[model samples]
Target: MKKLFTPFMLGSYRLTHRVVMPPLTRMRAGTDGVASPLAATYYSQRATEGGLIIAEASQISQQGQGYPHTPGIYTQNQIAGWKIVTEAVKSQGAIFFLQLWHVGRISHSSFQKDGALPVAPSAIQPAGNAFTSTGQRVSFETPRALELNEIQQIVDDYRRAAENAKQAGFHGIEIHAANGYLLQQFLEDKTNHRNDRYGGSIENRARLLFEVLDAVLEVWPNDRVGVRLSPFNDVGDISDSDPLELYTHVIKVLSARGIGYLHLIEPQVRSGLVEDMNHEAPPSVATLFRPHFSGPLIVSGGFDADTTEQALAAGTADLVAFGRAFIANPDLPKRLELGAPLNVPDKSTIYGGAERGYTDYPRIDEIGVNTSE
Candidate 1:
């Protein structure tokens, strides 16, 4: 049997397989920022016994929101909405995790309360468009640099959000520090131009991330917390002067803390775009960071069954995360094991839609395959 199909121990949990479903944002939530009822069905359809699933990125506070209809965990209604999702996923005996997110400068004022400008580590304007509350693409605004006291508030927000996830029945939490979001805005040099404790040197720039992790760790054990990072992929037009040095320090500290896992996005896959599997790549991100991170490492971005198995066999990645493939194949593990065909995902319905592209994907058995024969 392939290593991808074999059982593996992640922290204290025994996973039946190494195939993980990473967080994918589908803007199907209501204007109140509560998850749709269909979200429960969507997640339960993909859950497998002893498998791991990281649900979509959810805002930790109203200030953390950047896009329309994305779920939030701060409100009572939001917590109740996610409780249903967790219950459905738990019914399948799978380990469910919620990815905590704060979009930082990747926002327009329209999405903020009182139409306040988005906040980031600095008041820099990223070179991209922001999605408005009405789904219009508007130019990115120069974000307000978070005040020294305000930084502590954001940290508190993360802690409160972690508590909310626990209330929502999540087994764990994954901090969204990757893909040029708020946390990454603080990590990279281009986005963070502050002279305070949160900027300048590599250690200073990484202070906010460490602070957020420490805050979240206060709510749950370190072993139940995961941190996701994108060292090479430059989404949000953000980059660091020396990614290797920065991530090396980050991974080493995380290793020392003995977190549950370290999830890295492969360099080949750009954020918010369909992956080009045939693209040539440099040394794999997993291989580069494997030696530094002592805990279980999950590598996401454009991985199929063959590559996933190869990654596990090579010991470069303890687990592999599939985003798009899993979006189209609800029973992805069974399909991969049976060598069955997968459904093609409709890009048009990937975000802010109802049940069509979200939970309607057919299982292998439903496709008229008879594995029992």
Candidate 2:
């Protein structure tokens, strides 16, 4: 457990610990893609030492947006707004990174320019509901297939977003290639059916993702940048013919680029092996890239304190990220250090639930018990 607080280099910045605040979609921004005051306060409270905080996914450009009030990095107003956030986090001894994102067909026409259907690799539509501008939940529309030349424009958007993020006072940027978004749309065979150089074979399917990474890397040195990949366990109607093979090929290619670290969201960790013997945990795509990647790896999704400590001890992953737990317990590291019980989060407030389930989650001390910070 003491090793979790040890300092290490995650690319260019020397992090005080391996505990990372993974990019969770906290839908608390203004319509113009600006961080709200609540968002600022929400992050400020969780600010602490030896932890690297990656802000929620923000759109690279207006066309990159899908969810309502998810924030953006394309405009001055947006950058200025995020500067308030990064500055606040840094002031309290926490380093912050902006997660650059593009939702692709995961968006609705009601959210696009002149109600245009969102653009994706092909005309395939994802099965999901998107939050509309009016805060209404709407279904996603089939996206327009992107032309070859048009792809370059999107790649350029990532580069410009990286530049904007740096100017916005963020310490670094994380390319949101995970969780069934634009990059995921292209990486998965079911979503990408193009026959051009950007499609077909693994290299072709991985072309756009690599190109976007190339564009962003042009602005951000490999050290100051990181990329997240979710190769298996499809959520958001995202799946490939062979997810493991596709991700290994992709990781083998991207890992060589020397980005900060490849964050892997792994299978659910068991609690006392559960009584259900028929049910087993799923496997992670990390095993495929384990031999391919040489940099530090951060693991996320469905992890508890014990599993996290165990993973680090077994060297399966260098870092562990807690999502729901982090949201409920601002003093997560401290609580874990003390082996204290955690505050169970109310599922209702997971998104757009206001302060009740958002920032109001009490620390261990708020319940009449105290833990040193």
The superposed Cα distance between candidate 1 and the true structure at residue 299, in angstroms, equals 0.6
What clash count does candidate 1 reach?
Answer: 0
* TM-score attained by model 2: 0.92
Root-mean-square deviation of every model? 1.9, 3.8
**In candidate 1, which residue pairs clash?**
none
Candidate maximizing TM-score:
1
lDDT of 1 by residue, 25-97 (tens): 9899999899999999999999999999999999999899988899999999999999999999999999999
TM-scores, in order shown? 0.97, 0.92
Clash pairs detected, candidate 2: none
Regions of candidate 2 where Cα sits further than 4 Å from its true position = 267-282, 370-373
